[model samples]
Target: MDSRVANDDVSYSSEAAISRWKFAVSRQYQHLLDKSTPHVLHRWIGCFAVACIYVLRVYTVQGFYIVSYGLGIYILNLLIGFLSPQVDPEIHDGPGLPTRGSDEFRPFVRRLPEFKFWYSITKAFCIAFVMTFFSAFDVPVFWPVLLFYWVVLFTLTMRRQISHMIKYRYVPFSFGKQRYNGKRASAESTSLPVD
Candidate 1:
């Protein structure tokens, strides 16, 4: 797959060029995430702080054209997961629904992995929040109305999502790392003693 998923705004013509960039960027990006992943509580707390700051700024300044657009995009991304089946229909999911006996051997793969989904949303909000400070982004509109609409949209979207999850029996979140036992029986290990 193209590293277009990583940075969608940028595009490369050649697969080789994209792969080279992916390899280089993933190492650095993975290192950053590895350092931060351990601090789960801190991460959530930081996210909350960023959100509160955004709300407070928007409330005080009454500027939310960019913020509203960002929220729309964010909600659309969330809706994508709710609408999509946990197991991708496109890929012939080799084994049937992964269960205890068959699941261990099967790789816990997903079409839209959780980390990428989250990173995109977080990046969007952060960029939008930064945009709030710039006067150019502030169009003269009643921000409270926009905020109200967002809240209503969020509620309706989540309500349907909960029902869909219950009906489908699928979880959108990825738990801890999927265990992959790579040990293989070599020819030497299986060969009989030569006498």
Candidate 2:
């Protein structure tokens, strides 16, 4: 009887340990997914919506206001980014991954951060609101025309951005570096061998 009781206790403890390990792993995966995939998707969606609204109406008073607000918020965000330290001291001390020396030398990408997505959405809505007031939707502007124009602009901008990113292997998010640096980089890399 004593042996049986000891064996049962050991089994129970082992089961509890396995359950705890599974829970920890699940939580970790969730954190990684939240940080990477969903964050990027949200940003792209917000930007796309805003672009759509902009192309639909060129001269919206509300669009102007929303754009102003977004610009203000974006400027404030950039200021905060400039003021904040590049590295998080607390993260360094915590059990997070060690920073690579290469990471320090990399340029900051101007990609919109997660927090700014809401502001972008608000900006889109404001632009849409202005269009509604102006009856821009009633205008003979085809939806495809707006979508195609936006796509072309977006593609051109993204291509330039990607080209710059590939050449420098860095994204410049600072005020001075925010604009697409690809044309300059491409002009410079003309001498390099293409794969």
Candidate 3:
């Protein structure tokens, strides 16, 4: 009975140690993510690098076309979410984006923020890259057909999204609007023009 108690205590202590270790590792990872949050360019560069690596891996294997197709579809969905507003004007019954120039300026909020979009894309590529190693994902299919189909879908989706933007009179991008660099005209300048 004493030996049994000792063994149980040892296992409990080991489990506690492992839990603590995992918590520490999780906290460290979260800290790194927080630090990287402000560095948008760096985050994007890292994601791009991961994407390139995944592409290279897929190209070298010459398989996993299904995984690639699934990844492409997932990315397209993410892109649409990133481009769209949180509450779509046409679908939801609420105050939508400003349609006229005189309306109040409300900044466009994305359904999926840029950081989440980047993270999801990076993670998806990583998973797809891993899937390429396994033969199960390497289902044989004509690559050109998938490519052509993705292109057609992308074109149609983008066309609809652009039309939605036009209808709502809202631009998703921050720099899409024209900036007023010239100085504002004073009341005196307008009076002189009247004379």
Most TM-score-accurate candidate? 3
TM per prediction: 0.54, 0.32, 0.87
For candidate 3, what is the TM-score? 0.87
Q: Write the per-residue lDDT of candidate 2 for residues 7-37, one digit (tens) a residue.
A: 9999999999999999999999768656755
- Pick by TM-score: 1 or 2, better one: 1
lDDT of each: 0.65, 0.54, 0.90
In model 2, pairs of residues that clash are: 108-171
lDDT of 3 by residue, 1-195 (tens): 999999999999999999999999999999998899999999999999999999899888888888999999999999999999999898988777877788876788999999899889988988988888789888999999999999999999999999988887878898768664334545545566544
Candidate 1, residue 144: how far the Cα is off, in Å: 3.8
Give the alpha carbon lDDT tens digit for every residue of 1-195 in model 1. 566675554544466688989999999998998787667667667767776877787778766765666677575766576455656533655653444553544443455555555556566668878888788888787656776777787788778767755654455555664554435446556778989
Q: Model 1, residue 122: displacement in angstroms?
A: 2.7
User: Order the candidates by lDDT, highest first — what do you get?
Assistant: 3, 1, 2
Q: Predicted candidate 2: what Cα RMSD to the true structure? A: 16.8
What stretches of model 2 exceed 4 Å from their correct place?
A: 1-114, 133-137, 171-195
Off by over 4 Å in 1: 1-30, 79-85, 88-112, 171-195
